[model samples]
Target chain A: MDSAGVLLDAQGLGRFVPGTQQWLLRDVSLAVRGGDRLAIVGPTGSGKTLLLRSLALLDPIDEGRVLWLSQTISARLVPAFRSQATYLHQRPALIEGTVEDNLRLPFTFRIHAHQDFDRRRVASMLEMVGRGADFLARSWHDLSGGEAQIVALVRALQLNPTVLLLDEPTASLDASTTQTIERLISHWHERTNGKRALIWVTHDRQQSTRVAQRVVQMNAGKLLEGT
Target chain B: MTVDGYIELKAWQVAIAASLVLLNAAISLGLQLGLGRSLVVASMRMVVQLLLIGYVLRWVFQSDSVLTVLALAVIMTIIAGVAAVRRTERRYPGVYWASSVSVLVSSWLVTSFGIAAVLQKADTWYEPQYAIPILGMILGNTLNGISLGLNRLEDELVVHRNLVEMSLTLGATSWEAARGPVRQAVRTGMIPMINSMMVTGIVSLPGMMTGQLLSGVSPLQAVKYQIVIMFLIASGTALGTVGVVLLSFRRLFNRNHQFQSGLLTAAGHK
Candidate 1:
C-alpha cells in the first residue's frame, strides 16, 4: 500500500453497552490504504459488524480516534465522514420508491443537492449491475433479494464515496447471483480507478479471500489474527 | 320545577343510568381480560384516572374558578407527557419534561381557541364545563397519539436502525434520516383519531352527546357539542402528537446523532 494511501486509521476503540462489562469492540486498531481491499472476517456476534459500524462512523465509539487523511474525524464529524464512506447494510434496505429514486436519494438532501444529478450515469451504472431501463421505474417491492442488493450497491456508488463498508452484501443471494454481484463489484472498482477502499464484513472465508488484498479476522469483539 | 334548581332524579332512574355506565365498564373489563397484562394495566389506569378526574372535575366546576381549572388542565398536560415518555421508553431521561411542554402548549391552544373563540363568545373565558371536559378529551386523545408516535419511532430506531444509518452515510442529516420513520409513525399514530372522526355519529353516540342529553339539553344541541368535541379532539391529538414526537427526537439522539443505548429497553421488556 502507498504511504499516502492511509484513507482510514483507527486505534484503541471500545464500545460497551451500559450495565454490561462486555465491550462490543474493544482495543481494536486498523489502517487501510486507498486501493486496499480489506475483508473483516468474523462469525456471528463477533463484532465484525460493530467494527464496520465504527469505521463507517454510524456508531459513536466510546474511546477511540479515527484518522482520515491526517485529520481526526471524531464523533462530531461522524455524519460528514460517514457520508463520504458508504455503509451498505447486511440486508439491502430498499426504500418505498423506484430504483431511480433510490439512486438519486442523496441528491435530495440539502447537503448533497449541489452534486451533479446525472441520469445517464445512473442508467449506465444500473446497466452494469445487470438491470434494464425499466428497472429505474420499477417499485422496490418488485426486486428480488439479489436485485435489491445490487441496487443498494449502485445507490452507494452513485454518491462517489471514497470508501465502502459492505456487511455481507451477497449473504442472502444464491450462488449464481453472488457470482454476478462479485463481477459487478469488480467492474465498479475498476471504474472508480481504485480511488476507493473497501472494508467487507463477511463470514464466508472463501468470499473474503476472493476480495481481500488484506484480511483481518475478528472473534468475539477482538482482532485475533490476519491484520 | 325551577329552571336554575338542581333537579334531583328519582333513585331508580339514577340507579339505572349508573348500571348502564357500569355495563360500559364491564365491557371494558371484558376487553381488558381478553388482552392480558398490558390491557389490564391500561384498564386499571383508566379506571383510577377517571375516578380521580371525576372528583377533580367536581371540585373545579363547583368552584368555577379560572385558576383552579387552569391548574387542573396543567396537571392533565403533565400526566399526558409522562404517559407519552413512559410508553416510549422510561429510560430516556429528560424526554418526559419536553413531552409535557409540547402536550400542554398544543392542547391549550386547541381547547382555548375552540372554546373561547369558536364555541363561546366570552372575552376573558374560563368555564369549567366547556373547558375542563374539552381539556380532558383533548389530553386523552393526545396522550394516546403521543404514545403511539413515540413507541413507533423508538421501534423504528431499534429495528430499522440500519436504514437510518444507511441514510446518514448517504449524506442525509440526522433529521432527514429520522424524518421518514417519524412521518410514518405520526401518520400511523393519527389513525385511531382519524377512525374516531370518521365514525363519530354513525356507529355509536360518543359520551359527550350522551352526557349532554342526560343533562337535559336538546338532541340537536348535544349533537353539535359532540361534533365540536370530536373535531377538537382530533385536532388536539394530531397537533400534540406531532409536537411531542418532534421534541422527543432531540432527546433520543446524541450530539453525534447516534441513539444512546440508555434510551432503549430490551425487546419483550415493555
Candidate 2:
C-alpha cells in the first residue's frame, strides 16, 4: 500500500472520566499503517473499549494528538475521521429502521452521503458476507445478534474505510457464524488490495491468532509485551 | 331595584376551575410518577417554586421597580440552573454553574426580545404581572427540556460509543460523531412537550387558559394568551435544548474523543 493507506498516527493519548478522574486510557501511543491487522486483548475494565473509541475517534483524549493524513484532528471531526475507518461496536446495535436502512446509514452522512448506493453493489456485499440479497428488505427486529453484527460490518465496509475497528465483533455469534465472519473479513482485507487496516479487540486468544498479524495485550490501561 | 355590589359566581365557573386543578394535577402526576422519581421530585419542586414565585409576583406587581423584576427573573434562572444540574445523575462539579449560566443567558435574551421590543404594548417593560409570569413559564419549560436533553445525550454517549468511534475514525469530528445521537436526544426530549401540544384543547383545556377564564378574562382573551404561551414554550424548548446540548458537548467528551464515563454516573433513571 502507498502513502494513501497510512490511515492514522495517534500519540500520547490519555482519557479521564470528568468526575471520578479514573484514567480509562493513559499516555497510550500507537501508529497504524494501512492494512495493519492489530488485535487488542485486555482484562475487563482495563479500558480496551476506551482505547478502541480513541482510535476510532469516538471519544476524546485528555492529552495527545491524532493525525489523519497529517492534519491535527480531535473530537470535532470524529464522524468524518472515523468514516475512513469503520468501528464495529462491542454489542451490535441496529437503528430502528429497515435492514436496508442500516446498510445505507453511512451513505446518508454528509461525509459518505454522496457515495453511490446501488442494489447490485449492496447485494454483492451481502452475499460476500454470507447473507442473501433479500436480507436488505427485512425488518431490523428480525435479525439475530450475529446477523446484526454482520450487517454492521457490511455497513462499515460500504464506506470502504481504510481501517476497521472491531470491538468483540463476534462475541455474541455462534461458532459457525464467528468462523464465517472471520473468513469473510480476511477475504475482504485482501480484496481491498491491501488498502485497508483492521484493529480488532477481543478476549479470545485463539480468535486473535487466527485473524490478526500482531496481538497487543493491554492490562490496567497499559500495554504489555507480547508472548 | 338597585344592583348589589357583590359579584355572583356561576356554576360553570366553579366546574372549570375544579377541572383545571384536577387536570394539571393529573398531568403533573403522570409525568412525575410515570417517568420516575426525578420527574416526581421535579413536579413537587415546581409546585413549591411556582408558589413562592406567586408571592414574589404579588410583591413585584405591587411595586414599579425595574431592578426588582429583573432580579427576580435572574433568581428564577438560578433555580432553573440548579434543577438542570440536580436532574442529571452523573453531574460534574461545574454542571450547575454551566446550566445556570446557559439558561439565564438564553431566557433573558429571548424574553427581553419577545416582550420588551416585540410585544411593546405593555404598560411597563418590567411589569411583574406580565413579565414575571411569562418569564416563569419560559424558564420552567426550558429547565425541563435541558434536563431531558442532557440526560438522553449522556445515555446515547454511552450506548452508541462505537458508532461514535466508527465515525471518528472515518474522519468525522467529535461533534459529527455525537451529532446524530445528540439530535436524537433533543428530539426525544421534545416529545413530551410536543405530545402535550398535539393533544391540547382536544384532550383537555390547558392550565393558563383555564386560570385566566376563571379570573374573569374573556374566553377569547384567554385563548389568545394560550396561543402565545404555546408558541413561547416551543420556542424556549428549542432554544434551551439545543443550547444546553451543544454547550455541554464540549465537556462531555475528552480531547481524545471518548465520551466521559462520569456523565453516565450523573444521569438518573431513564
**Which is the leading candidate under lDDT?**
1
Q: Per-residue error at B235 for model 1, in Å?
A: 3.3
TM-score of chain A of 2: 0.91
Deviating ranges (above 4 Å) for candidate 2: A1-30, A42-48, A62-78, B1-58, B84-94, B117-119, B148-152, B155-176, B179-185, B188-217, B253-258, B267-270
TM-score of 1: 0.82
The digit string of per-residue lDDT tens for model 1 on A1-227 reads: 34376888888888887557778889998887778888988779999988888877777778886778868875566667777777888788877888878887778776677787688887887777667888889899999999898888888877777888889999989998888878867766666677778888888999989988788899878987685
The digit string of per-residue lDDT tens for model 2 on A1-227 reads 24454668777888887546888788887777867888888788888888887776665467787778767764456656667766778677677788898776666567776777777877887787678978998888999888887877777776777777788989878999898788768877887676777888999999988898999998888776554
Q: Where does model 2 sit among the CAPRI classes?
A: acceptable
Q: Over 4 Å off in model 1, which ranges?
A: A1-3, A74-77, A137-139, A192-194, A224-227, B1-7, B18-55, B63-67, B83-95, B114-127, B155-159, B194-206, B213-231, B259-262, B266-270
Per-residue error at A14 for model 2, in Å? 5.0
**Cα RMSD (Å) per model?**
4.6, 6.5
**lDDT of prediction 1:** 0.78
Task: Give one digit per residue, the lDDT tens place, for model 2 in B139-184.
Answer: 8888888888877877777777666655554445566668887898
